[model samples]
Target: MIRLARGATGFRGPHEAPLPRTEAALFRAACFTAAMEARGRAGEMVPGEVQTFRRAALSDGYGRVFTALGHVHLPVVAFTTDPVREGEPVPGFADPPVWAQVFETAGLRVMGVKELMTPLEEVDVSELSPAELTEIRYWKPSCLGDVLFNWWD
Candidate 1:
């Protein structure tokens, strides 16, 4: 089972996505391109652009962690998105419960692990206070506009 912290913001999302470092950098590039498009600056002619965006959407580290956190334990949880399942269905998943069972076999008394697919919208965002937001720097991350424009020469 995988567990992660997400929602470093109030109105966004997270997950335990496994992406190559190169791919992650490309994902950031795609985000910049999309932002430019929204501002009518980027033309629609970039090759392999969608692939980067799709990578960003799929392997967003926070999306993976936040989504998983809603389902997994708070602090003590193990998670993985690498060697992901591809194509047709596989039998078992490495969710919390499965990991618990493995731990039991190893002589550890695990409480329980349940699978949940609740959407990020349903998460208890109200728990985040303004002070917490400030402390976490929810606004410090790259804003879409800034991310689009900020770059090396």
Candidate 2:
């Protein structure tokens, strides 16, 4: 089910849903890091900033939270693939445009792209045929830092 936090605004499609708490926590950490990096405070994050980010995250909800730092909107998309078992290697894409086309075919709009610093096990595209990857059930938020961060934040 798609659950919206109080006062949040964004597109909530039939397939979209609120992020789990663990995912939300990780996204919060990533937002804090991105916001700090933009401020030249890379290694020093204060409680006040955390508080602000937490507020924004809660207010913005899970699907597309906008940070206080500005110009950065969370990118929410998931690939259609089975969950990666432990010790399994993550899949790689040689052509991003084609990879994106897979998502487009599944009814998801490709907002922006960002490289994952850490691999996410929940989003495993290894076993999916190109056709299977275009199914709606395969798309959802699989990891933190999956969204893009701009210089403003």
Candidate 3:
């Protein structure tokens, strides 16, 4: 059943679910690493240190997101090859278009917040417990990014 969280963020949840495309995660890892390298942010990154893995979310259709959570101290970095306006800030873990292009050229499709948010109308909560939903209500994610990637302590 699809339901919107009763909070200020207006996040819709439990939409029609699609399993995370884990196969693309490693490609995303390479893209992220390349972006970091292009930005000179790879100085501290160890090869194979950028890990791509999935995590469960309380309010999302594709509750499991394939992401790279290492090689930097950011809470979480979601990679995507979606086009970005010049100098436009990409939500979640994204670099510049030039940097993103590297992965796009390689034929990898990493989901951005927009792509991730599109399936909000198709949420299915059969798997989530009542406690999890309650916690999500308290969190009040401001955007899909918050729900998909976070460091909730």
Candidate 4:
């Protein structure tokens, strides 16, 4: 499992408030991306795609913590937080050891833990095409997950 927290970077949404730094918030975002990929819609997520992702994420017991908090919405822009500086304590919001134990108990190997920072620019306003933007948003988190998991291999 990858643990993420808010740092110098921040996130914004098209029609909602800024992303919170709470564990539930991070879990929800991760689960949303996971759900999108699971449904093979990792390229573009339309407004209607939300319910499907919600249902899929909720089906996984680990995601219940987020679902129980109420409705979950897709963020238009999500910047990963900056990596924790070496020798610095991990943020309280992202307790890596705790998360590692949780995944271990679930029989999942923790390839690594990552702290995601939001990009400095507005991804939504980039010159990239809409499809490209969507694809980036959909795959960013999973890409990080893959990289972290394989870093030692």
Candidate 5:
């Protein structure tokens, strides 16, 4: 169900239903990171750290939430994500696009990701036949539904 977090910012809309406290914590993390990145206060992100985070964020659907949480933890990164555009291909599908600046809070600082277009690739495509693949035009489908939001966040 869509929800809202009415703060000074007044963010409201399709909030992930039943967001668990743990996931909410991570969301806060991403928000903080985003804020930090926005003000140029985010710590430097090492090359390896950047790759690691990119991999994690692109590994699965949930990774997007992780990245989002990362922004919460750093704030500036959220600003870097810039426009969080979520598109609905159908009744139960959404693909969110963002321009993010990522930062590693560990050893490095101010290593932010920018103009990031991390597409959440769909899964369960191993058995796709040639015709099926052709019909789909690609092994991975777009606007992956349940798989994209089947979690606490």
Candidate 6:
């Protein structure tokens, strides 16, 4: 099964995803775009133009360098049009679990190598390779966002 890990280049690792790297990137882009739009509609935050897009890995260092993925991962940065108190993080960046929940509520699915349309909660840590598990231990992920927005490499 595919294990999700967000990286600089994009989601990567030895895990096998159902879609190719390019397609996966595009899918993630679309999902995030829709999610941001929803957040805007709710008057929570205004979705900004994507600051950057992650491509595919070029070598063994997945998510370290750029490669020709079919699609790109649009990492959108959102902001609040209204003034906020000091020390407050941006709306979208403030709470990642909430943001990930937005995606989950929208019916977005993270595909696995063997499982079709698996939800984020169903992702099994036991399926991960020993090295990946070790990485997870190091990252100490607490929720879906941590897994999806990591710098494992």
Best by TM-score: 3
Candidate 1 per-residue lDDT over residues 12-129, each given as its tens digit: 2234333222233333343344333333221122222222111111223233310011111121212233331222111122353222233234332222223223223333434444
* Tens-place lDDT digits, model 3, residues 118-147: 343355434444544555568654554444
Question: What digit string (tens of lDDT, one per residue) describes model 5 on residues 38-120?
Answer: 44332322121211111112222233332232221112222122222233111221222332333334312222222122232
User: Model 1, poorest ten-residue lDDT window?
Assistant: 66-75
The C-alpha TM-scores of every prediction are 0.23, 0.20, 0.36, 0.19, 0.24, 0.32
Collision pairs in model 2: none
Q: What digit string (tens of lDDT, one per residue) describes model 6 on residues 11-70? A: 335664532222343334544454454442121221211311222212111212112111
Best by lDDT: 3
Error of 5 at 37 (Å): 1.1
Ranking by TM-score: 3, 6, 5, 1, 2, 4
Per-model tally of clashing residue pairs? 10, 0, 6, 7, 45, 2
**Model 1 misplaced stretches (Cα beyond 4 Å):** 1-73, 81-93, 97-117, 131-153
* Cα shift from native, residue 122, model 5 (Å): 6.1
**lDDT by residue for model 4 (1-153), tens:** 332322112233355444433233443444454444334221122221222111111222233221111112222121112332223222212223222233233332323223322232322234333443454355453333221111110
The global C-alpha lDDT for each of the candidates, from Candidate 1 onward, is 0.26, 0.27, 0.37, 0.27, 0.26, 0.33
- Candidate 6 TM-score, true structure as reference: 0.32
Reference-based TM-score, model 3: 0.36
